[model samples]
Target: MAPPNLPFRLIRPAPDPVLAEAVLRLLETPEPASEALAELAMRDAPFTLALLSMRPLQPGEATTLKRALTERIDEAGDALLRAWLMHTGSQQLQADAVGQLNMRAGQVAETAMHLAIELRYPRPDEAYLAGLWHHVGALSLLASTRDFPVLRDQPATALERRQAERQRFGIDQIQLAAWLAESCGLPPTLRDALALAGAHEEHVAGAHPLARILRAAIHIAGPDATLDEAARLTGLDTERLSNLKTDVDYLSTEGLKSLGIGAPGAAEHERKPSGYPMLPSGWRAVALGGLLAGAFEGIDGKRLSLRLGNAFRLLFGKTPPLMLTVTEGQVQPLPMDTAQVAPHLITELGLQVDDDTSVVALALRTQASTSHFPGGDGPGRSTRDWHLARWLGTAGILCVPWQIEDTPGVAVVGLDEHLDLPTEEQQLMARLVSGAARALAAERTRRRAMDQLGETLMASQREHIRRVTHEIKSPLTVIKSYLGVIGQRHPEDPTLATELNQVSQEIDRVGRLLGQLAHPESATEEPRSTSVSGVVQELQHVYGEPLFGQRNRELEIRIPGGLPPVAIPASTLKQVLLNLVRNAAEALPEGHRLTISSPGVLITDGRHSLELELADNGPGIPEPRLHHLFEAAESSKGGEHQGLGLSIVKDLLGQFGSYIFCRTHPERGTRFNLFIPLAKPA
Candidate 1:
């Protein structure tokens, strides 16, 4: 079955200089540099008005023409179609508006290129290239004039046009734009802005390239605004008013004057070469210009976003001045370009800021920072900018730095608000920042611990003194009471007196334990004589108890023949030896032989001394528990032993500028080696 041939109506001969010349000039530099593409699109934003007044195309013809245009180019038809639809209002029409969109896009692109060349916004070729598609919908709208009566005549007032559009078709041009945007798979930013273009009530949105270029291009072209109320409602200030009044008339009357061939007035704009890099031209403008007073917001480093669809929109369609609102705490990752930004309703989403430090900062840190962490696949980070430029899917991210409660560091958080995407570097930075916050929290915790420890120490000392006093007094009281009772009641019984004697013995034992506990040095004062050999012998006799030994263990104490013990305090040495032996016994396994080995343990303070070592074959202590194994009260915390054992050993040993510790092993056994002074004829 052959398709029916469609009717062909000759497009009216356009305004001699105004129509044909503009299109011809647009065709001059069709291929511009990439950076200039955005500026070109912006300059040609009002492409719909131009095509409407210049070349009127029917929906069918426009569709065919659009197919021809894109097919002529070596790009994917689907990609071109999608990109165009996203930026245009063409989808609102029953048939295709491709032809009108294509033609107007080409013209606008060319004109914007020329404007870019004049303005000096980097590469004019690229700007003009993008300018071509600045108004796909506008051209589409103009092309469909034969089918839709709503667009029959250009209204005198903006409100009248809006009302007429709503009455006739239940939607304004913006809705058409949104329809096209959705059909083309445009970025959310573009789709949203296009949908709200004519929705005055919803104008609190950010200024995206879709809106900025569309409206700005119209203003650049012959502006058809006639209503004062419309101006007030749209918030068109005096500067915009004057620019529209002058630029519009100039473009309309002069037919693209000098084509910006050599105009110094247009030289201020920056240009860019056509290549994949950090940002598009509009973003460059934002970075340099700071904000769009026309759009009314300061969109800086925080509100920047790059959308590939928007790039196409700016390159091949008309757009409007975008409105943007940005706050610091709100941040998101742009799916199209994989850029990071804060919460924003933007008109011109172009400001691109390059932060290199942010890259390394997130890379080195990947720890948790918050108590409640939302689960995700992994951290977000990217070393290469292009890896993040996948336009396959839509994703959103929000990152905010927060100090974790009771934690030491600040944390950055990434969110997929709609779960559209899970960006990389954007997430990583958030996590890294969070880790730092946790570190800060940890430091704070340590400080608080130290303060509490000091307070505890003070209170503990008073309690210990009180307990010691009571212990000392209680023994004396019992002895005195026993004596009194024996003299009064046991006067006629010898057996009663013997019972009293046993009571006295118990009281003496308590008194001895208390004395040892209270004054470590007061038990027995040993003469200050450095007798290393005698010290070893005394230690062996004291620790020779069999009850403390393991079932299969043999406790052996040996002093090699070459050893010399010249000077030492007998009591302190005894205490140190006793502590080591006790610890060794505790650590030894049942039925295992324990040997105290003193290898060549060196001791020197610019002088010679003795070396003693006690090595046993038993289970070795774990490495993690080694550092604090001899910190007095902390050694036996896991066991039912008073922490004072190692504490007394260390304290007595410190006074002699010497120390004693044993290296314990697992497979072979434990060894306690000590270095005692061996002076020669001192």
Candidate 2:
């Protein structure tokens, strides 16, 4: 409901149909340039206001509306501009009323530019802007009231027309236009020009230069003002004024032609029925419900809101309703595919739910639908609501609250000030909200179920690992006890005693490895420097007897003296060397020799590294097998061999920033090279 003192609702003026069609035709080209769009936007006051209203303003930044219009067109690009134009052009106004207003604005704009040049005004462009938008209040009145057209066409002076406007609407066009300029945060100079442009001749004569220019331009552009009267008002010679009038008339006529208004059949074409038929209420509800169901199919929790927003747009058209998510007392916009709202604007437009005078806040507190018109003369209007209206680029807002289980939110729908929301439409909106809420709840439930199943599987895997560790530890304990008994019984032989101690050390290593399997999170060890020669000597002692001596194969080591230590743990390096030597010994024939050598320090990838090679003269790996040699595969050696030796070797080398590569030829032999990084000095 509106205030009792207000005679009519205040709404944004509908865009001129001719100008809108011209812009639409421009957009029809495969790629419409933004410069052309900016020029078109500057010509129409309503289009200019719409563009400036949607642009996000920085705090304390002083940007003129005309400059901001060009910046926004360039930033928003073609797709968003087309969508906004299509949405704004959908609303129909009286064709005659729109045409009359457009022509008047054009004539005033041209006349003002000519007058500013003659008077040598400092800001001629601003003078033109003031002239073009001085009549904006009339457009608003036409949109807000039915009888404004009759009042607009009266054959009276400017003062008489203003008096009649004040008597009927309790406010004149100048005041309304001023208020709109203030709401858009236009510069105070421009606002003052708009506010005082319709003053009496005596008052405007002593006013600011822009106000005086606007008043004289309006007079010259009027139907009844004579050339002599315009010259007297501006203090110019009649001959000069007549020449300016001729130019203004020609320019205004050209402007009208460019807008497609004076062309043949343009008026008749605009007068036809422009509204599309709508479906019945029940069918609309069913259609929306079907779409909402499809939105939820195969969608996870993360994408549920995005898909729901898309469904809302598809059902409600381009000027779709906005869905805002409420969390921790703040409201935010839901994600959408298109950039309907810019990211920076979203950050600036976020609202608090605790605000007392906000209708959106009221909707959230009471859990009901609410509407507000920030441009109206109602009592409880807040500055925040005014800012929201400007940011949304709408005259009115409708807020519908929704809740999904524990989460509560609101859906903000843009509305025209004079358009009342029907009961059936409201009901359908409620159904849409309810359907979206239910989908959200279902998605939440599915996510919780999946989390629970993952936890159960992880627990089962941990328990199986524990049982396997226990079984392996039993055999390891028995082997250690038998080695202890043999060491005690073989003390008479020093060589045998030394071998027994080596076996005991290997058994302890197996025990430590078993402990790591049960507690894998504690397996990481700090890196340490190991002597390359020391690790090679230890490998020869540990595996030489069983792997090479028992197989009747020769082992050759060619480590140079004074080699730098490698940046790997001693235990880890020993384990890697043991695996490689064991593999070579098993694969080589009875008398084949395995050679382990270090070719000294070499620079690799801008780092000093030790080049270690293990070469064997055995039958080289087949080409097909060598391609996937490092991958874990079935063992050709059979019988409990998992064939994971090369894979494990690669993984261990990677953990220490080392690299390994193999070159094998069936005729020549096979060689494995390891580039181990050298340790840096402490």
Candidate 3:
């Protein structure tokens, strides 16, 4: 299982000046600052190119490494270094005929760091550098030997490759790389780590942690590496192995660009740091819990805001304050962040409709993020730079507009930190926004529905009372008529006279029931111009047979000639008449007569109008119950009828500036008189 030492390799008695200088630089600063490296690269393009040509960095290869160094390194410096590395290497590989070996070295470095993270190896950056430079010896040998392509193209095992290399050059790539690392003053650990690539399987397992990780990365970086194979070699599960592979692919790609490896003149290129926050394991579920808990706390809106802030804190290092412009019909914040603004601010913003250029407005329109400066600057200073700064303080403001389908309003949020993140992290923030929106939308929808239902119920109740009043009024009129007739004939009889007096008192009481249906002065809305005689005739034809024929009651309607149109809808007049006729038929017994007479009248308002009187002959209503006739749920027919009919008649007529009155005589039956206004001539 041991790797063989190649037999032939050229040994350099002296190192090249460029190589010697690079080694000297390493010796001078064992751990160079990222800033110094960036400045050095910027200062010398050739040096930067030479350094990048040292290894290849794949795109996005340095995410984990950058994250690990975020707090420890200068971000700008790190960015500059990465950008140049990508620019240089990418350019060299594209232009140079022999760039494959160099690209492979970069790939090795990227994969090594990935494995380091997966295996929890220490000093991952150092491990990465070690892996990248490990193949420098091979590259140097290939550069000198014109037909080395033949050697590289051979399908050979690690052991066979070393043997072939040694046979040709008198030394193998392993020995050459070890010598270079030591001469370059790379730490002994890195030097040893590089040597592990040539170790036997038994020796590999017992090597230093970094060396073992590098060996695994080197194995997996081969064209044929698979998840299962990587797992077996690195002791990682399939899931971890897959993750490591993905990380390696992305980090290496990015790392190459960061190091300016691929792009030759792109050393000045600025690579955007992954806007994505690096979250801890299982942080997504925790964030979801906070969102749900906050939403369930109620529609008060504060709980959800607080939970969102908590989720932000967990995803990012610190939680910034958030301001939510909650709107149903107007913009206002939850009770939490309201004090930040005053009434003048509200007026100045004029958020009732919102301005197209305001922060909230832009958020609603664009659905993208913006900031005042490179990093988020404070309020006032950048308020001119970005409108969001007007409200959000020193921290940068991030706004996302959310809406509910079929709702008239939207909620715009302004947060004090950057929300730019990778897709997964962005989804988390989206989930939070969406969850809050759904909760708010649901609440607004529910409240609106409840309001509509309440209005419908009230209207229905009012209609019910009106119908019952109309129904009872007709019978009560009959009762009063009978009492009056009895009194007229029984003046000499005290008992009969007392009963008549009591019945008269009850009829007076029933008239008072109309008071409950009284509308405030403002209730009289303008009436539409309509024909009164036509409405009456229509009602008579529709209901005359059904109601009158059953009880053997005859309905007679008499209208004077040239009746003017009325100021009421035809439907309203028809409803009122139908209720009146139905009441008359129900009150009158077999052989009783019901007559409707319309008499022309000239009102003081100089309007021509008419009064309609409906009279019916029927059994008298009881004196005790007569007083409650027009009251809601009160009925002369006991539970069989609700006393809403005449109340409805009054309500309908009032709409057109008209009204109804009732009169009756004992034994003469009941009569109802309705007055309707005539429309002025157009």
Better of 1 and 2 by lDDT: 2
Best by TM-score: 2
Deviation (Å) of 306 in candidate 2: 5.2
Q: What is candidate 3's lDDT per residue for 136-165, written digit by digit as tens?
A: 776656544554557766999868988887
Residue 596 Cα positional deviation in candidate 2, in Å, after optimal superposition: 2.8
Score every model by TM-score: 0.27, 0.52, 0.28
Clashes in each model (backbone N, CA, C under 3 Å)?
126, 0, 83
Model 2's number of clashes is 0
**Model 1, 1-682: lDDT tens per residue?**
1111112211111111122223333334555232232222233433332222212223333223333232222221122222222222211232223322333444444444434444444444334423443444444444444534345356557667756656654555555545544443344544454454454533522454334333333334322443343233335564555554455344532433333221212232321111112344345333322211111122222211212212212322211101111223212222212233222321132222232323212321222221111224333343221112111111212323333553222222222133222232223233333333343334446668989999999678756965876767686877768676766775888755655565464455456556666655567654555555566654554345542442456667666655655456765676677676777677777766666556654657655656666676767777776666677545443657876776677777777766666576568766655555555564
Which candidate do you rate higher for lDDT, 1 or 3? 3
- What lDDT score is found at residue 643 in candidate 2? 91
Candidate 1 residues lying further than 4 Å off, grouped into runs, are: 1-530, 547-552, 560-568, 597-605, 632-639, 642-652, 660-662, 679-682
Model 3 misplaced regions, further than 4 Å: 1-348, 351-357, 372-396, 403-427, 486-507, 514-682
Please report, in order, the local distance difference test score of every candidate based on alpha carbons. Answer: 0.41, 0.70, 0.55
